[model samples]
Target: MTSPLTRNEQNSKSRAQTFGIRPDLFQAAQDHMVKKSDLDELSENLANAGVRGFTAATLPQNIHLGSPDSGTADYAILPFTDRYGPAVAAHPEPPSLQIEESGLWTVTLNLGTAGHGLAPAGSGFFEVSIYVGPEQPAGGPVRQYDFFNWRVELDHQQSFATTFTVDFVVESPGDFIYVQVSGMRGRAIEGDYTRTRLSVRKTDNRTR
Candidate 1:
């Protein structure tokens, strides 16, 4: 005859039976079981590793243009009235998207123009520039990065549109990105805010 099992042994045997495993195996399984704390930590890490980005756009009624003769002598930043993203703001001179984390980023600029008025009688062109740099103090100068241009023949007035893209690395936070547009001499370039947009997105973990 065998002696009856102790209360703890009986309870262990009952749990093992429920799992269809031997008591020794069930006891070892406890070591590999996932704990609640471990799951919570994983959730937090995933949230921190998510992607970040920003977009700033304008409307047709609020688009800004220089004098007809303003020409290509210089570039003017596009006044973006609407913005979407966590790091975008309306201040700090030349309003821009402020970088909150360091990483490789892709910047895109889209521009469109309608032929509302008479352009020069000959050929003319429009230029688009993308600027990226650290936040500047009030009245500080702007720095330029990527530059693109679209040539249009003034033989007949028509519509124009183009997109520019660039990839660069941000090594530190607090950087800013903006867009500017210009036209050839003797012609004033105007934008259709309905088709104009600027965006910046973090694409990688690189910071080089």
Candidate 2:
């Protein structure tokens, strides 16, 4: 007959066998034990390495379109009025973002089309474009970096929404980024300001 374990022995045994069946659980527990200060330091280090800047802007009001110009198929720039973060500054009408740092950035554009008479008469394509170039010669021509075409079929009372994301290398500190939209087949594209957004984030430390 063996004697039973004492209270101290039983407690020690329980502690030792706490993670007996799952070693992964034990490892997870160890990982969760990291101090908050350690995490703060890690975040600070990442920021210092140029991997933590993000900037976003939103349209201030819904875009209103006039009669569609059937003679042209050019893209019109969207205006961004509100800004968030310190990495970029939002320009006035014909909105553009002024880059304050030179690095590899991931740019994302979100658009929400309102149900109106500006859409195509039938199923057609809507085009969105992103341009990046110098800010000095305001209104000057810019290089198109990325573009997306979305097929939308809607009546005067239907809405459409889409998102576009692209990675771009910005080598000029004072460069400006612009977003444009156009409608095909002699139509126009308009968006709800509340749902339209443009965001930019640094993905790497390469500043050239």
Candidate 3:
């Protein structure tokens, strides 16, 4: 039997034919890669926004805003598509008021863990102040021009989970819109407090 060629020789012979090389094909490949990279970058940016975006499920405590204290930027909730009429999941929510604000639409809020000692059945209760303010243009101070806020009590029944949903619809339009979902709990499992926050964004009107 003939002896097998050495690995080095085999590699050299293989290297002699870099067959997949055509100027047009190479250019097309590069263009495709570039397009794909751009798309990837765009997708990542949106994901980052949602991951860190403000809503009702994320709002924290004390942060207040607006005239007459109409709506509070407390906590932000996701899957907003499931909010409003015909919820996919039967939302066992507390008594919610039909909210109406002005100037800004598409409100956003954020929530976070505040202290230790988790709340019972995640059903602690307290009064919260919600707001939706306008974003400062490019470089400016935090302004509440055309903003509104209000106070309401929020009850949680989502035990063994981080947070729950409390979505709303903007009955009007304006700027710097955000949401806040906060209140006092009867002390969670000694150091397990939930903190929430709010921020706002604009989107095409598709009420859920």
Return the top candidate by lDDT. 2
lDDT of 1 by residue, 21-128 (tens): 656667788779998999999999787565555545543343434346544334456655455344431112235555666788777776666544434455555556
- Tens digits of per-residue lDDT for model 3 on 42-89? 999776543222222221133221223232222322111212322211
**1-208 per-residue lDDT for model 2 (tens digits):** 9999987676567666665534456667878888889999999987677655577777766664435555334455777767744543233323777666777887788878754554455554555667776642244345544444444444544567777788877776666777767654333334344568887777765865
Arranged by lDDT with the best first, the candidates are 2, 1, 3
- Give the TM-score comparing model 1 with the true structure, all chains together: 0.64
User: How does each model score on TM-score?
Assistant: 0.64, 0.60, 0.24
Q: What C-alpha lDDT do the candidate models reach, one value each? A: 0.58, 0.62, 0.34
RMSD of candidate 1 to true structure, Å? 5.1
Residue 7's C-alpha lDDT in candidate 3? 69
- Identify the candidate with maximal TM-score: 1
Off by over 4 Å in 3: 1-104, 110-124, 127-129, 133-174, 178-182, 185-199, 204-208
- For all candidates, the clash counts are 0, 0, 75
Runs of candidate 2 exceeding 4 Å displacement: 1-51, 66-74, 85-94, 118-120, 136-158, 184-194
TM-score for predicted model 3 compared with the true structure? 0.24
